[model samples]
Target chain A: MTLLNAIDPWLAGPRSAELLFPTLALPVLGLLLAPLLGARWARLLALASLVVGLVLALACTAALVAADAPLVYALGGWAAPLGVELRLDGPAALMLLLTAVLLLLIGLHAAGEFSVRAAGRRATLAFWTLLLGVWAGLDGLFLGRDLFNLYVAIEVLTFSAVPMVCLKGHAAQFQAAFQYLLFALLGSALYLLGAGLMLGVHGTLDIAQIRVALDAVATHPPDIGGDARAATLAAVALMSTGLLAKTALMPLHLWLPPAHGGAPAPASAVLSALVVKGSFFLLFRLWLDLVPDLPQLHVGLLLGGLGVFAILLGNLMALMQARLKLLVAYSTLAQIGYLFLLFPLASGASGGPAATAALIQVVSHALAKASLFLLAGRILVAFGHDRLPALDGFGRAMPATLLVILMAGLALVGLPPSGGYLVKSLYASAAADLGAWWWPPALELGGLLSAAYLARILSIALSPAPASGTGTGAAAGGGHILRAPITGLAAPALLAVCALLLGLLPPALFSVMDVARPGMGSATAVAGVMLSALTPSGFWRSAGPVLTVALVVVLFHSAGESAWGRRIASIGRGVAGFEGWLRQWRTAGALLLLFLLIQVWTSIG
Target chain B: MNEAQLYGVCGAGLVGIGLYGAILGRSTLRRLLAFNLVGSGVFLIFGAIARRGGLAGGAQSDPVPQALVITGLVVAFAATALAVALLIRLATVAHEAASAAATPGSTDDPSTPATASQGRGERGPGHVGAGHS
Candidate 1:
């Protein structure tokens, strides 16, 4: 009886075993039926899946609230190093809940998509399956404890995402998908190299085990042997740099604009909203857990530098885009830059629970960006093109969609009473308290740039003169063809309103942020001088500061004497040549071999 | 060499040969095939690495990497499926365009393109369905 008990732990007849909070089961429910249910069925099924997911995610939050620390679940009673774990800690749980909620919101907004059958039933099937896969993979990524398992989840994410780019199989879309695939492959390879290196020195692929191994190596110098230390640093760089590429950080972001630009509206929302966060989640995990002892000063400065570069380059790229979707894509790239800035702005001497302000910014950014993409997508569908000049009459044509987009754009631009503006204020106050003044300028610049690019649409929205308004009214063809299926558009607008509404109740949002407070709290009152008080007047005066920053950026990136693009042309190639070492024979082959050897050694050692 | 080493060596050779073909091959489809070969090499390398983890000191070679390889195999399949779908669509588009190009002064002829595609699209029996193909 004792021997049998050991072997069949979960096989108990009564199943007295405690049920987990049931996070994994939420997605598993959808996956079970995704193959059988046609796309039409998958829509309601996905909504139901997310609804269950949200309940479980909230339950997890409540559990955390009650437990006051992380709640770890071991599948089938397995513990961490031996068994895979799901840690429904504050941050991950909050993210999961947020992901579920936003997914449900976006899924609602993207309604009738699966029913269109425009690209045929197959396209519809692929879309729902991929969407479910994305949700599952992303959920898996955030919850997964093992590093190697996280890598597999991340790979699944990219595979599911790339096909969405060419769902309709247009020539341009194919090019975009191909580019996305190649870059994603390169990023994966780099991530694997770094992860493999860590495993090599540690002999374990577990996160906690690696952290301890790294800590021990730090104090004891066993795996910290001279060459291994360099390898470790190299690993950190490769991993972060790869993640930066995925995050579309500055120069490595050639693939993002086109990829996001080409995908269908709902798919674009998922891609822009959730997919990138999966990578950033890893970055947060690595910095917090594995490299906890990394010299904070250097790490902070390096991350801060990347953030600044992204801020400058993202806005500059956004400024140059003519197509509306591409413009939104560039704006997305810029928003991502602001996210990287959170590390520098929020971390440092104030690097405690007080840094909850920075974490709040992360949540804010996710919600806001998701809303923005959904808004852009709806506008595209309504107007039949996402070109800048083309959006002129959409406000009249798509009043509700336009109204939602404006609200989302307001949040994106950090306007008053919006989540983005409030999040930025918190981040700004934290930055100021940390004595990092330059970050304020960058934050202000990013906000202003968001306003500028967003204004391209708003300007068109508020345009006094009619823009030809050439197209027949929504119903020239037929009833269904005339008006957009309301569910797809309204759902995102509701999400946009929620993002705006969260700002009104900052205290509630802060409490949610409190759950994920893994770092030490400095106990500083991270609120700032009133944003309203920072101005001479109310809305118009606030616009002045943003407008001034906009002028500076325009002067900075503009052509002719002050042409930054022309000037950079001289140095860009040199930098590219230096960094393009993957083209070299020995370096490329040796790097690959080294990585393979590391993996082999880890399994053996 | 020995069995494990032989497998490892073969995987490495496959990766090298595949990389060579991708670089040299001008044809898009050939390059894609080479890419798949490289993937196979990586899988084989993984198989070789796991060999030591058997009941020997390696203790069945870490279920994590094995699981990773299997997931990777599935993902690779999806990517290949998408790639093939794009290729078939591309060939059709290209062939139609080329046919139009061959018959000069047929720019105004709408049927010129459809007729060219009818021959291929009409005889599309036994073609792989979207996902499976």
Candidate 2:
């Protein structure tokens, strides 16, 4: 009876219940229809489903806003601990809307790439089917209220994403895909083990029920026995470790760059921008909602410490990459690091600023990274290769694409009036409120590193073409012109602009971050923090990183002539060597176990 | 010891062995089989948990974990099938690359040499030794 009442607080009127079912169902329907219909019709069906999915997501957001509460729907009127439940809140709605918008635009771009007449019948059919499958999996992850159900959702996401990595069927791609599959399989296995442990201890798979049970155990430990706490902590530790591996946090990120870089452009865009976020969203939910009262401060610090390493090492690795796609892929490794900072920052009294900052960072990075990847695809098509050094004077050939890269780079570097700038300020303020003063300097250094790499690409791009009439030998000999479809360029251009303009959004709109967790961040607080960025002092703070980037670029340009340049080059090679050593299968696997052990020790201690 | 406790210990041992093999397996195929061992261990734990639930109260066994184990089994089976398919595809692709390298007239594919060099450059000699073995 108490368990029944425990669910009462979460039982809201299902105002948007109708909207939730279709968001998941529409994608499944499209995937199902793709095979029955031929290739051309399947592409149309896929696009149609995404458009409808977007509308459904918007309607869900509207319904949630109107009700001012999360919408929870029980499957077949059977309540939790028995039947499944789907919960829709502010964060989930925001992710739904973001996924819908990105997928639709990427779908439009994909329509041209995978057109029946161009990529052949089989590949076209496969791409559409896999895209919709990924959409359904992401939607499932966002809405699932049962921990076991969420595990299934993540598996769905992994299976669908792995095949897309090797769609080209090349040997290198096959190797990348194989490694990706192995890591993901290991992750899910551990996750399943943890879920089983939780079920054994809690007697329920529903997240709400487990939380209620945990609270009960906390209040009256004798009722459930002392071992329950240890079991619960161990279970949470295992689950978190599994999620970290799946999210590819720093040391666990060995599989990401190659898998993401080797995929087709549209696939890379989706993988980098959305697929990784599914596991991250689950991790956030586990820490914040499921085990908020547990002794996790040390765990948070461990994760934040890892974030620092990922930012420094990933950016350094990106700076050394000779291929445009791999550079962008390594940049993803760095951006993922920023997401982990939320754990430590939010662990303090004020979770509001950190939560809002992390949300903004996720949305903006998704947009910018997707745009950069699509643009990389455009460059590949125009030059017959994406080798960075050979891309000199590409700006002259594809001015619009270069412009898009600049906009995306601005967001990546967190320049003023961009989402990156807003996130950095919020992070600094959050760290200040927590009295953790070291984070602001780390964020600034990370921004500077990002700027150094972007400057490398832009400087090379803007350099003059050689005396011959060609920029790249491949482009010159192959006669590949710089003509790309308008949709290909326009789609990425729109996404990059959105990333830059994210900061300009009204502060009141960010109240969604506080939606189920009301004290997380208020509108006024967010407004004040955002407004501070526009101040003269804030403007100067933002300018400092830009100036440092300029200096780094100048140093790099004169590197061949100076002794300082040689020293910096040697350091770069050393970082690359360290990264190479870390990426070995045995090393990464050993690190996974070591991280799991550390996570367990922290949680239990 | 009680049956449930005994099974639980066995499950934990299986998990430890599976983790070791999955991490240090010499080939992708071995790793896939090791993953299956881990899945079996997890399922065994679930079964033991159900038995413990039965000893604690209402029914002969808790139906929920049983139901969960079934779903988990399906997922694991699907995962194995997919991994196997990918392994076969990888083998075929490697064979093709090796044969193409051996053949004299197969230089029509411009991407072959570039891919070969890129693989060597990216993995380094150390990785080639550890990864492909």
Candidate 3:
């Protein structure tokens, strides 16, 4: 028997093996059933699948916690080296639960967005199928323990997501979808190349087995003239470069703004909130579990450097955007930067503050970004455009949307009483522990930069209204913004509330994150540890400074432009050309190659 | 070099060529074709690895990588079809939009000038819907 089976034989049994059904099978089944049923029924079934999925995910988590070990299932009853294996560990469970919850909210919000009568039967059906398809891929991706299986999951995600981007059937949407497709294909190709090299080096494609083999190789250096080590380094670099491209990290982020900004609101939500996370989740597995010791410091620093660039460049681009959706999409690029910072802070396996902080950032950003996109959709319905200049007094026109959006904005700024604040504090303490003094300052400044853009939009939305409320109530299509149903506002409000309340959730809720923190079972103990980790000094050092900085930014934004402001604004505008150039395919490809070369050189040397 | 090494080098060459073409190609069709080329290269590398006997059973070649390659091929085919369809639709839409803009009066006889103006205002050029880029 394999070491994993010998250690935890019960996990290999059929006890919780059925959980994979709702995750891997049900979404594909829902998609297959979509064509036979009416569009409305298909949507109902899609939402039903999410509900079932969430329950199954929760059950799996409970089972894992109770068992105190990861649950592993060998597909077709054939163990790894012969068949695929599905592993449900702590982080996998958390990601599964996160995907299910967000898909449900996006599904509910999409039900109204893509009506059969309004958007046509075919479009509605396509949206529902793609939604279910994406869920299936994400569920499979999170649970998959085999490298090739994860690759297939990435392909499934890319296929479903590309179509969703072009659901509107617009020329620009098609162009964006096409661009997204090519870039994703490039990413998967590189990923597969790396997986193939690993398979060639080791006889198994299973993550656990590969980890054992890699550790052995590291411990006992084989006298093959260092070729094996070079190959392994190449594999790591190629795989990471591929996943980074798919995740839209900095220079590789060319296709993201166009695609996410071009897709329908619900599609954009799923793409931003979940799809990007799929690749990131795989990279997380690679860094933390598979090759944790190989070129650790250099690779982590390399990724962290890219994260810094993404933060500065993404936020600057967002600040320069004229349209609200593009602005939100750019903000997503910046938020992705925060997720990558975990590489440097959590490079060691101590599993302290940074890891949990990154997880909180992921969950908080998923909810807040989804809510913001939905709110942007409502604004579009109200004004027929989401141009910042034209959106003056929109808050007065749509009070409910504005309030929820403001809450989302607070979360985005990483302000206190929001999960963003929790993430900021956790990350700061972790950075200080690592003696990474520069990150804390960069993190605070990123919060301020993000605040600048959000405040700019909020100021416009809250500007003085025209003489009559009803005058602006009628959109160009005679669609009445005043007639927005309570149900219409319910989803965004729910998401916004969740984002805001994430910080307030019992530290025990973080028990899910403990899945990653193996051997740390006691919820109370975990909570206590997290509490001590969040000393008042840590909190004040990070969240307090960030909050104060954001407040100053908002106030300065409210006070209107000064000479200094104009100069900074001009600097931002100056970078606009660079941003536009980066979006071009040739430049992006050159950067990808450059990044791959750098990573390979550093890892090998 | 051995057979696996030879095939691997060729695969890498294909990938390099495909990436170069995909990046430099301005047209959508050319990029899609380049993507397919990259897929072929990746699959070729998988074949090379399989040929190196990277499986436990001591079979002639690994069946697992072959299985994975099949799936990858299927996914790539689907992607290609979708990309081609999108390119076609984009061309048609652009053509229709150009025609409409070129001779606005000839396309619609029933609508008054005011309705036409309103239609243009609602779904005008450069005014992407719902903030779509």
Candidate 4:
């Protein structure tokens, strides 16, 4: 059928069927060929699929933006209300294109790190196939208009993702993978329960139909049965809470660090960058698209509160980490916290600038986190360990990698001319506009916390090698230890550049984000507020937090290195203590039930 | 209450019990069983809905929910298989660690804190959080 369509110009022109190129066809083909393909060939095929997927995603984006409406394709030509539909709108296109680009870059990097000839044929094949599977799942998640179909996509994502965590076959890695699997299963079960409840009430699992039904029901005030209202609230709470666990939001994020930290570099990159976003994309669908005016202010606040905790606590944990990969994993947790700001910000102004800021945060974090993890992988390999203290003088050995890290760190710290900066400013302004007077400072504090953690790593990496002849490269005594592969360094460097340069792009680039967008009118006003932050005074106001964080890092470093040891260790213990308490299955379960109860109470009360 | 309503309540009760067991159980296998219990409960609710809703004359139950429940069962089976595989691997790993720890001279490479705590054979309930410690 694809071949036939390819030959027929009229049938082939910008059809919604093109969306499947990345989501289904590529993964299926990858799985089929994985057994026969060698490592090198598998890498090539991955690269090819990613490039083709990127082009297809761009085409869909262009077509959707040009049409200024969602592109909905009915499978077997059975329209919604009967058969499943695939949809590509502004947000879905953006996420799809982002996933393709990240996968392609990560694929290139993985080629260097996971050489088929070096890591055994089976390992290479498994890694590439799993990578492709994650891509396929993410693409489906972005485009899927049906809740049940999205659930299936998430399952594919989880099944593919869990193995990647235990690729090393280490005892610890196995534990992490097992924990990850259990958490995902628990989360998905809850999500399915919600979907089942929705189906029982609405009789259709299609989001579009549910939206229409809810709208029709909303028009009749007294006709709204209390039971239906409670059911909808329970359903929303169940669905989003399930997604929160998968997205690794705080209180539900205990499984993320170990699993993400244990994975191979490319796998970690894919897990951190794209896999988490899959659940988040669905949360977006539920909040912005499906139930925009649900009148669940308390739910929004609860989510925002969790986001705040994730940011602060995630950053604190990242700062406390002695190892590089764990540090990056915790940083991902914090960045996820930043993403949650959208819920509360969106609560105030419908279709406001907050959603756009959240979108920017998603894209920016995806690029930065992928770049950091890849670079961290390179550092891990070059130094033979990822311990923070062991990273001393590594900058001297691999200056290129250090530069990539620095650029990525700057993005993470929300410094100017980086997408993270734009995201922070936009979020701050959104909070200010919401009259939540407290949020702007919290936003600034998060940036400061981010700077403190990033600075901790950069400062350590920049310091001279320890006096003892213990550092990896410096003490090797060989005038020429093997250098990092060009392929490995190049990909992270390129991704870092992309993350750094993203903020410099024209505002017009964001126009595509408006299609099928939830709210209206307030967006332009919010955009104006965000653009004003680019002015000199606005820039200074925003830059103040970054400067303060820099001074704090410097002052902390100036205090005898011995002083930092005790203070940091105490902080570490406190953070770890709380985290340990939360990590217990019993506590996590209790919290999950508590959140559900609170959500149901808020909606009903 | 009608037959479907009774089934729905039964499903809800199963879910509550499963939730408690899954949360409280210490052993991995027990939790896995609890997860299956929850899945069963959810599937039962879906079955009940299908039976109650699809009474357009000749049908016994709605084919859609029936089909979905079947798919759900398949997914749940796959999940169970995966969990069991993990549990087997974990048991082997624990056994190996215990053996390695008993042999004193084998403690040369405490490459990570987690492995070190694992080597001590006293990883206890706090062992899981040692990776980043």
Q: lDDT score, residue A5, model 1?
A: 72
Candidate 1: segments with Cα more than 4 A from true spot: A1-21, A116-120, A221-229, A295-302, A345-358, A464-489, A520-543, A547-605, B1-85, B93-133
lDDT of 1 by residue, B33-62 (tens): 766776777677666655644424557565
For model 4, what is the error of residue A320's alpha carbon versus the real structure, in angstroms, after optimal superposition? 0.9
Residue pair clashes in candidate 3: none
On a 0 to 100 scale, what is the lDDT of residue A213 in model 2?
A: 78
Where does model 2 exceed 4 Å of error?
A1-15, A221-226, A294-296, A347-350, A468-479, A558-561, B105-133
lDDT of 3 by residue, A1-605 (tens): 68756534333344766566556777878878987887877788888888998877777877677665677777788888777778887778888888889998888887877888779888998999899889878888988988888888888888899999888876667767777887888888889889888888786778888877766777665665367667777887899899999999987887888788868888888999889988988888887777646325477788888888888888888887777888899999998998888888873553457767777788899999999988887777666667675566777677788889888978887766577877777777778777888887777778888877877777676766444545533232234443567687888899889897776677777777676455433244335434643567745654565556556766776677799889987776568767766766777889988889998888777
Alpha-carbon TM-score of each model against the true structure: 0.76, 0.94, 0.89, 0.92
Error of 2 at A178 (Å): 1.0
CAPRI grade of model 3: acceptable
DockQ, candidate 4, comes to 0.34
Q: What are the clashing pairs of model 1?
A: A109-A488, A352-A520, A352-A521, A353-A520, A353-A521, A354-A521, B53-B60, B53-B61
Error of 2 at A66 (Å): 0.9
Tell me the deviation in Å of residue A111 in model 4.
Answer: 0.8
Error of 4 at A519 (Å): 4.9
Per-residue alpha-carbon lDDT of candidate 4 for residues A253-359, written as tens digits (9 for 90 to 100)? 76787788878888899999889988988887887777747435567788888889988888887877778888899899999998888887785324466778888
Candidate 3 DockQ, CA atoms: 0.27
* Full candidate order by DockQ, most accurate first: 2, 4, 3, 1
User: How well does candidate 4 score on lDDT at residue A176?
Assistant: 82
Better of 3 and 4 by DockQ: 4
Better of 1 and 2 by DockQ: 2
Q: TM-score for candidate 3, please give it.
A: 0.89
| Among all candidates shown, the one with the greatest lDDT | 2
